[model samples]
Each structure stands twice: as C-alpha cells, then as structure tokens.
Target: MPVIDFVTDEENLTMTVTAEFAAPVERVWAAYSDPRQLERFWGPPGWPATFTTWEHTPGGKAQYTMSGPRGEKSTGTWEFLAIDAPHRFEVLDAFANEDGTPMEGFPSMRMTFEFTPAGDSTRMSSTTYFDSLEALEQTVAMGAIEGTKMAMAQIDAVLQDLRDYAQGKGTRVELLDDTHVRITRLIDGPRDLVWRAHHDPDLVRQWMLGPDGWEMTECIAATEVGQSYRNSWAPVGDTPGEPFGFEGEVLLFDAPRRAVTTERMQGMPVETLNDLNLYEEDGATLVTVLIEYPDKETRDMILATGMADGMEASYARLESAVLTPER
Candidate 1:
C-alpha cells in the first residue's frame, strides 16, 4: 500500500493523507494530471471513477462520476485553484449533482496536494481544509480517511510504465478488494492485433485454447455494444476436463483500446463485469482486465479454479500461434 499516514484534526478542521511511491515526482504528478490515469484510482476500490470533463489549468474545473458496484453513482466536481507543475496543485472539491451543480448543505474542501522527493522515491501529502468543525467531522464520519487511503493505495500501479509493470510477469492477479481483482499480462504484439485476437472468431479460435488438450468448440464474438458473445471449449480425446462455456453482453466496445462486458458461466445466474484495457508501446501490448464480482464468496470461488494459470497459457499461445506469424 502507498499511504503511510492519515490524520484528522477537528480543531484545525483538516484531514491530511500522506503517501509514498516508488516512482519519481514527475511520474507521480503525471498520474494526477492525466484524466485517463487519474480515473483509474481516484475512487475507492469497487467504485471506479470516470472523468467526463477535465481542464487542468488554474481556474478550470473537472467533473467526474464514481460508479458503485450495484448501479449506484456519486458525482463530484473540482475547481482547480493553483497549479505549480510537478510540485503542487490546489483544488476546491465538492459533492455535486448529475448536472455539475453543487449539492446543498455540503461543504466544499480546499485541498492542496504536494509532491516532494523522498530519496529515490516520491512523497505526496494531501491536506483537505474544511469550512467548520462540523464539516470536518461529517466528512470523517462518512469514511473519508479510509476511502482516501484505499484510493491512494492504487496509485503505485498507475505510476509504473506498462513495460516495467507487466513485462515478464505472465498473467498476474491482484486482489483489489473483497469483490474486485485486476489481472495483467504483457503480450508480444501490437494493440490492434491483440484486440483483434480477442474479437475475431478466427483469431480467437487459433489461440484461446486454455491448454494443450483443449480446443475451442464454439466462438461467437460480439463486435458492438449491447451485443452478446459466447464461447465454449471442450477437452480433446483422453483429456480430463468437461465441456464448459461462458456468455456475456458487451457493455462497452472501443476497438483496439478498451472493452467492457458482463460475463457469467452458462446456466449460472451470477454475473461479473469485466473491464479490459489495452496499451501498446514499441510493438508490445499490455492487457489489463479488471473484474468486479457480485460478492466476496463468488470472487474467491472463481479464482480458486486456477484462472490465472489458464490465462497465462492462453496468452502464451496468443503470442506464438497468432502474433508470431503475422510479425
């Protein structure tokens, strides 16, 4: 975890969070300045944020919505007060409605975020100034301290370069929270080819086989939002496993960049949201899949079935069987 200290002072009407990262100050600052990167960790676990409007200059404003696990959403806005490059920035943060109007009876906080060098690493201190003691206590009672800590804990990954973070890591699973997990794999192919391999039936059939003894018996790729996709696999002769399949509807489809789908096993009622993102640098693509389960029990049950190992095998096959020939 990145957060080192969280302090709340009622007399001063302040809440401060201190965190340290293994990255430089500039890299850490970039994560906050970029809307795409900031959205990845701005909210607590299981409640990912989407920034709709971001103007990084002083006197500009940003609007965002944090979507909860069960279709709930909370909107917020930030008015940039100051920007000092890779050193510090200040903003007025407040709760807002869907149309960016500030909510009534809620006090806004003047937040100052400072980044400094801590030896080879970077140290960040965020102090929130409330208008009154009641406002400070109210925010703390609403879980501000713990929520900020959880949110900052996710920043380390964002500060890392894709190649440095996922290369040679195989398919690794990170438990983000009770019901959320992130999986990453570095593929030796361009972003377009990697995305095509996921959506093209012919390419998927060539590499999606989980193991040597298995074969993809059926594949129906979904190419657009609201479309449904299905895939089934079965073991070859003398193989040990039984036939199984999964089906899902595509919620988001941004070709060659990102995709989001609702996945569930065939004949099962439970569902999980799978958010897939692809980033490429120098002919290599990093694949990130963030999955949100219905509950902790369901999350553990699914991961216990050796999912990461199977994904690693399939990714290796994708590189050799699908990408190598095209290179």
Candidate 2:
C-alpha cells in the first residue's frame, strides 16, 4: 500500500505532494505520458476528466474538462514548459474558459512532477507554485490537497491494472448509469473454474473476504435459479460486534456462463440486482458484475462507501487466490 502526503511551503509559495508507488518508473511514466491513462486518474472519484487536446512537446497546449456529478463542467489547461520523459514534466496549469483561454480572475500555477527510481519502486513528488501566498492558500481552500490525494490513490489501481494485464489478470470498473455500475475482470482460467471460485462456499470464503482483519464466518451458495446464497463476515481477532451478513436469491443461473441475483445487504432498505456475466476471451474468463440500484441517490450512496476501490483490491488478491491457481 502507498500513502500520499501533502506539504506546503508558504514562504516559497509552493505546495508539494509526495507518494511512492509500488510500480517501476516506466509504468509510472506511462501513466502520465499517455493521454488515455492520464484521464483515468487526473480527477477525483466523483469527477471524471476528459482530455480534448494533448500535445507533449514543449509549449504544447493541453485542454481538459472535469465533469461533476450533476453534469456541471470545469475546464482547465496545461501549457507545457518542459517535458523530460520518464523523469519530469513542467507546465503552467490553470483554470480556463470553455474555449480554452485562461480564466481572467484565476491564477495559473507553475507545476513540476518529478519521478525517481527507488529500489524497484518509483518516488513521485509534485510541486505547484503559485504567484503569491494568497494564491496558494486559495487553492488549498478549494480542495486541491484532498482531490490530488484521491487522484493519486486512483492511479494506484490503474497501475495495478497495467501489471495485471501483463500477467493475464486485470479488472476494470466504471459507472454505467445512475443506477447501474459495472466491474469487469479477466480471470486466468475457464468459465467453470471461475464459477467454482465464486459459487463454491470454501473458495468464496477464501477470496471474498471484506477488508483486512475481517473473515467470512459462513458461506452458502445453492446455485439454482430459485435458491439463495448467503455470506457473513466478522472481525478476525478479539472484535466486539456481531457479524454482518447478506443474502441473495438467484434470479438466473446458466451453468458456467452467467448468473443474476437480487441481493439485499444487511440493514439496507433496497435490493440490487447483480448480473454476473462471464465469457471466454483469449483463453481467459472475462467476468463482469453489473449491479443495479433503485435510484441514482442509492447508487451514489453505495459508491461513496468506496466499494469500487474495495472490489479492485479484492480482485487483485483473487489473481493469486483463484485465477493464478487455475492458470
């Protein structure tokens, strides 16, 4: 695991964020150099950034907009001052008008991103210098520190995906609609093995545990159209509370290809339909879990639980627990 730390030097008119990634320098470099990959992590969780113009050369102009949950848009631009591949990039980053012009009242920032190799990992330090102490304080008050930290954590998952793809195990999660969310992963085995990993109580207990220090105390999957599955988890050590549990009735089951369930979480008032879609691609199992809530508010609330990130973490572990074993 990696941690992002923020530091401010008021006298120098700069704010710095430092974090070390588990990946090598090249993978970290590719994350920022590639526009597509950059878009994935340039913004925080609720807001997504789309880059319209990306030119890496010196003095090149890069334009992008980050869209809010309500479809509101915030535009920005990066004027490249320098670009040193796999090591550093310097730019004038600023909020901009819709047409790409720098906004009149906002201050532009001189930003520098430096990456260094540290024993098979990469150390990243990003510094942003503003014109005055007031400008720096203003940006910090505008959620810059927290947003950047969140974005960095997101890049962690992106890096893991890159590593997984190289090993024939990778997963992707995206918002499908207000009520539907989709998570897809490439499992390194046939459909049946993947199915057993999910449906077998013993294997399910092994891979589906929630967070650290929590273990599934019980697991049961009937695997029939009308039958139900249940799981209960509790703290591993001397924890005080009772175990939490959830159950779902199978809505559809097609052997090793697909299954659907209307799952009800404990203490929740709503039931969400989870469609488990599986298919074979390139001698691997492509698994997609589509969960649909009753409304946008409900779905958004669930997402705020950091469920997406947890799913990624679990799938990362699954590569070793089940996928790799069947490989």
Candidate 3:
C-alpha cells in the first residue's frame, strides 16, 4: 500500500505528502467530494472544521475554517485544479485569517491526490508542493507532521465507521467449530426489555463481571453496529489488581435483538469476532452467543477466564431488572 509519506527538500524549501486508505476508490472519493462527510472527520481529532462553501469541480472553490482547541481558528480556501471522480483531484491550499483574508508570510501550495486500486483497498497518494524548502521546513517545524498524522487517523476512523454502518444488518462473526463454546439462553421477557438490558450502561455493569470484586469503571453503548464502546473493569478485592483492563467494540448492534463484536486496541492486531443473536418467542427473548477467536490458544484463554460465567451473571441481572416493578 502507498501509505502516508511526507517528503521535504531542504535546499528548495518544498514538501510533499502521500497516503493511502483501505477502501475502494469510489468510497474514498465520496469522503473528499461530500462536504458534510468531509467535515465530520476532517482536520485533527477533536478539531473539526466548518465548511463555508464547497464547489467540487475543476476551477471551483472550497472555503472552510479549521478550528483548534480553545477557539483558535484559521480559514482557508482551495481552488480546484483538476477533478476526476474516484481517481484524481488537484487543488491549491493557502492559509488565511479568520476573516477570509490570505495570511501574510504564509506560502500557498498545490495539493494533488491520486487514488489507485489495490485489491480491496484504495491507495491514495496526497502530495503537497510548497514553493520553497524554507516554507516546507517552517511548516514542518510548526507541527504539520503531527497534525497530518492526526487528520489521517481521524479519516481512518471515519472510514471504518462508514463501512460498519453500511454492513450493519448482517453479522460479522462466523462460527468455526462446535468446540468453540457456543451458548443460547432464553429469557422470558419482551424484546424491548432484553434490548434495554444490553443498551443500558448501568444494567451492563451489573452483569459483566468476574466472580471476585470486579467493577466496570466506564461504559458506553453506541446502539449501532460497527459503532464502538469501551468498558473498563478493575479489581476491588483484598488481592492485587491489574492497572486497567476490559475493552470491546460493537461489531453487530441489532436493536431489540443482537450484537456482533470485537475488541479494539490502540493499534492493529489479530481480529476476533463475536456474534450475539436475539429473538422473541412466546413473549420472551432468546439470546444466542457465538464467539470466534484467531486460534485455539485465545479461545482457551477466554474460556478459562470465566467469560461464560460473567455473561450468565450479566443476563441474570438483566432478568431481574426486567422483572422488577416500576417505581
């Protein structure tokens, strides 16, 4: 893959960047072409931009303000140089004052993006040509590299979210063998009640714990497939404890029914898939769980760690909550 790369010339005072994404060319193009979607994941993480105008065509103009933390803001404009759907786009980028005036002492540059097909992913190369090496060096010194890294990371996250939203209906986890420890439990409750047990953070904390004094520190339910949530668990007994633990993402979120899933880490690792199915039968709900790990070692470890016990307990808590009288 033609991953993101930044090249600077000391003698000429110029810089260029190239990066790729694991998506189709068309899919990648939609992100850049759609102003609303672009704003959703644009700029660095936590610093989103507001698009004033976007004319996505050759010779058209795009204006936006990039806002930083503490209300710091910089407006900019891009004059489209070329446009080829799902393939190529070129534009001029410049720094400007918040009032839309071009900033003095800031050099404008040309940005060219080329999208190429690489199997199931799109190799996107974005190159920015500065006027001189001084400009490139000065920009780099101003934290351009770190900012770009954050921006690309945001893009990756947004793309993954988009993919998850598109494939929200089906389950991502597949069952491999019967020895993988699959279980199905039927609860005598309405679908809404069962759904509430999984969707509510407080309810989730009640059931998802080990036999000892483990407690959930943080929990968030996205209520959508491919959306992510984090649950932190800590030991509270008289024994020693792990510093921080417990993390997972929503792989499948079928409201009133089931969820499929995986664990999210800071960086990439071997993929693990989990499938949860919910169905209503005779005024009650039945939940089926299927977990798939990369290898036997992981599967064995999960089983030995009392995962099923915790799950059963969590469901029991859910049952109690459903059966409890309304106050």
Model 2 residue 173 CA deviation (Å) reads 12
Model 3, CA-based lDDT: 0.66
Which candidate model has the greater lDDT, 1 or 3?
Answer: 1
How high is each candidate's TM-score? 0.86, 0.56, 0.52
The TM-score obtained by model 3 is 0.52
What tens-digit string does per-residue lDDT give for candidate 2 at 85-203? 98999999999999999898788999999999999899999999989988998999999987787666657656765334434444566675577676777666777778888888877
In the range 1-327, model 3's lDDT, one tens digit per residue, is 134677766765556667778778888888889887687556653345778989888999888987542345778888999998879999999888766677999989898888889799888777778787777877898888766765665465346553343222221221234324445565657677677777788777666564456677777776765577767777786746773544566654546645666764324465566556555645655565655667888767656765666666656655665435311
Candidate whose TM-score is highest: 1
Specify the highest-lDDT model's number: 1
- Indicate whether candidate 2 or candidate 3 has the larger lDDT: 2
Q: How far is candidate 1 from the true structure (C-alpha RMSD, Å)?
A: 2.9
Off by over 4 Å in 3: 1-4, 11-13, 161-327
**Model 2 / residue 172 / CA error / Å:** 12
Q: lDDT tens digits, residues 178-239, model 1?
A: 98898889998999999999999999999999878999999999988889999999999999
| Candidate 2 clash pair list | none
The local lDDT score (0 to 100) that residue 44 gets in candidate 3 is 52
